[model samples]
Target: MFLAMRAAVEETLAATLDRLGYPTDDLGIEQPPDDIDAVLASSAAFRLAGEAGAPPPKVAAEIADAFDAADCQYIDRVDTQGPYLNFWPSEQYFEHVLETGQDDDYGALPDRETSVVVEHTSANPTGPVHVGRARNPIIGDAVANLLDYAGYDVERHYYVNDAGRQIATFTWAYETFDESELPEPERESPEYEMVRYYRKANTYLEDEADEAEIEAAEAEIQSIMQGLEAGDEAAYERVSEVVDTVLDGMYATLKRLPATFDEFVKETRFMRDGSTDDVIERLKETEYAVYDEDAWQLDLPDIDKNLVFVRGDGTSLYTTRDLAHHEWKFDNFDEAVTVLGEDHELQARQLKSALEILGNDTDRLQTVHYSWVTLPEGGMSTREGTGVDLDDLLDEAIARAREEVEDRLDDRIRDDDLTEDDIDRIAHQVGIGAVRYDIVSKQPTKGITFEWERALDFEAQSAPYVQYVHARASGILAEATDGEGINADQAVTELDSRALDTPSERELLRQIARFPAVIETAADDLHPHAVATYTREFAEAFNAFYRECPVLDAPADKQGARLALVVAARQTIGNALDVLGIEAPDSM
Candidate 1:
């Protein structure tokens, strides 16, 4: 509904500009300031004034005067504030929102023909997922959800880094360690066990292992890599088993966030299928390709760095394999999005450069490089065993959530209405939601210092707060119908827009109406924080309306209208939470 109004405003502005003989090609419309009580605002008059040699305020006034109310039925007034033209929505518009906002696809965009692939959480399979590295998957999943809500056909992908030296080191470690003496797999996940041995192996190679042992390990890893490249069945099977075991633990962790990948693309596939070789051959034909120190390199003077595509021993580098993978992505989808940590910024840029050199469209690939997630103590390192495992973090979150829920539901718990299972389920949802929301609610480029108190806060801008608001709205509606039911469509049909006269009521309606616009903006900007912010604001608006106005206790004529508003708030908030990949329980 908001998007429709925005479009109507844009169209009216464009028509007014055309009538005034001003160019409307580059005119942009945005929301007015919060204090302005306007739906849409535009400073296009400022630019147009410069183009037409007129004062900006005068031009803005002229544009406002030229706006035809009939052309934009939703916009009741257009006024000038300095050089800005702001538009206010009519009561008819609010009524339109209350009527249509309860639809299942209320905030969804029109389905598009474009296909997008979102590849993320491609962590090395040698270690368990750590809290420090959790940002990528959370952000990536939210991006995919946002795009899906925006009507893009999105595929969530996990690029398995199975061909790398990490895997080889893991394999060597597993072989060298006596399984009987290693940490019990039941105590920690298999991935955690593998991580311990892998770190042990690294320490041995660096500080304790003899030169011959080091050489022997290196030779064995090379042999494994060769077998992998050659598609030897036994080698492939062995590596697959190890990677699959680690992935089992990783997937278990991700399931807590309720995130799932549509596909898993192995890096080894590129090497085994000759795509890596094709990339190397194509690079050799490019002017950027050079041979230095017996290695194939791409000398990019523009970036003042040289990226090696192949080592001195004729083995392909990670970048070479990644180029092939990106090419494959482009060929299969209209657009590809890769989510990585800030540390991979250079590699991402280098990947684009390599794609450009290969004569592929670099614009097809979008890389979102997020900053690190750290503990309050400091940074984390997987190899040093200083990183907090994702499983452990989730367990802590759930434990905290259980305490909060139990405290809040003390009466119900004592009455035997809220079972232990119920508490557990709600705790899991709230806990995972808290962690995911905390990470994705921040801008991608900013680092987050995860805190249990902040993350699990039930009163702050966390998921639990929003979920509680949703539950509160549900409670109001449930009471209105005496726990029977109030059909949202039927309730809306009885709505009288005149009853929505209070400031808080109008503000709630406006916020509920903004859901579609927020989704669109988030998808376009690749920022899930927009949705997160909107959900909080919507909840605030609803709470204000609830406090200032009576729903069931209102007069007969106003009761239906307020009930409709409550239903709208509930549906819109639920939808917003869904887009953020957070569940909105009807009862908290």
Candidate 2:
């Protein structure tokens, strides 16, 4: 609906420019300033004035006079202010919004029939998932949700780094631990046990180990890598066991955020299927491929760096495997969206460049590189055993949410028939929602210092506040039985737009009307944080409308109109929360 209105306004401006004998090629429109009493504003007149050698204000007036409101269905008036022409929406636009806002598909766009592969959270399965790496899954999942809402066919994936040295190190640590000294896997998760020894192994190699011991470990890891690369049954079984154990714990952590993947692509699969060797041969045929010493490298003079494709030891680098993986992605989907860390920015670029060198269109691959996340104490390292475990973080969030929920529901606990289990369920939702929203609400390229107080603050810009507003709107609709003959659904279908003329009501309607535009923008920019920001603004507008407008106490016509607005606000907020992967509860 917003897009339709903008199109109508633009058409009017273009027609006016054509009628005035001015070029319409560079004409554009933008949102007016808050002080301006208009829905759509444009400064095209200023540019047109310069082009036509006329005064800016005089050109603006001429364009305003030339605009025909009768030609535009949604815009009613066009007025000139200084060097701008402002367009206001007609009553028909508000009526259209009111009539269509009750449906679940209110803000959705037509399906574009494009398939997108979103790959993210491919963390090395070396330890339990940590807080430092938690943002990837949240942001990635939110992007997938937004794309899905925007009518794209999105396939979420996790590219497992199961063939890397990290996995070999994890396996070696698990195998080298003294059996009697190791914790029982039955009592503790295998990943948890492996992480303890993994840290010990790294520390031993770094500090206390002698050169002989270091060489032994390195040789063991290399042998394991070679065996896996050769598709040895024993090597595959042993490595798969360790990778599966770690992934079990990782998937459990991911489930807490409710993030799931449609597929899990193994890096070793490319090695076994000969895609890696094929890519190496292809690169070798290109002028960019150079034989440096005993290794094959891609000499990128543009970046003044040479990327090694094959080591002198005959092993392929991570980039080689990534190139093959992306080749598979491009073959399967129309587009591939990768969410990786800022540290991998150069690797992502190299992957695209290598693909381009191989005669493939690299533009199909979109990479979103997010910055690091840290706690208030400082940075975290998994190998040092210094990061907050995801399980521990969730436990703390749920515990804090339990306290808040109990306190909020203390007075009505009995009246609402609430039990301990109910409190637990609500707390789980609130806790996870808070964590997900706090992590995903910030711009992905910016670093965030995760703070407990800020994340769980109910009055602040958190998920709980938005969820509560949704619940509040729900409560109002549920109690809207004023003994009148008017039905809520019927009222929505028969809504009267003039009854919503109050400042708060119109403002709320305007916010609700912007939902589809927000979703489209987020999907186009690959920025899920925009949806989070929009939901908060929508919630604020709803709250203001609720406080200032009398709903059930108003006259029959006004009550029906306000009720329709309530229903629209509730539905829109719920949709926004869904896109953000947060729960919108009916009650707190």
Which pairs clash (backbone N, Cα, C closer than 3 Å) in model 2? none
Q: For residues 56-134, what per-residue lDDT tens digits would candidate 1 score against the true structure?
A: 9999999889898788979898899999998889888998898888777789999988999999999888777888889
Per-candidate clashes come to: 0, 0
Q: Against the true structure, whose TM-score is highest?
A: 1
**RMSD of candidate 2 to true structure, Å:** 2.1
**Each prediction's Cα lDDT score?**
0.85, 0.85
Once model 1 is optimally superposed onto the true structure by TM-score, how far is the C-alpha of residue 39 displaced, in angstroms?
0.7
Each model's TM-score?
0.96, 0.95
RMSD of each: 1.9, 2.1
lDDT of 2 by residue, 460-568 (tens): 8998988888888877777775346656665567678888998888888888778888888889999999999998888788888888997878887687888888888
Which regions of candidate 1 deviate over 4 angstroms? 51-54, 185-188, 410-417, 483-489
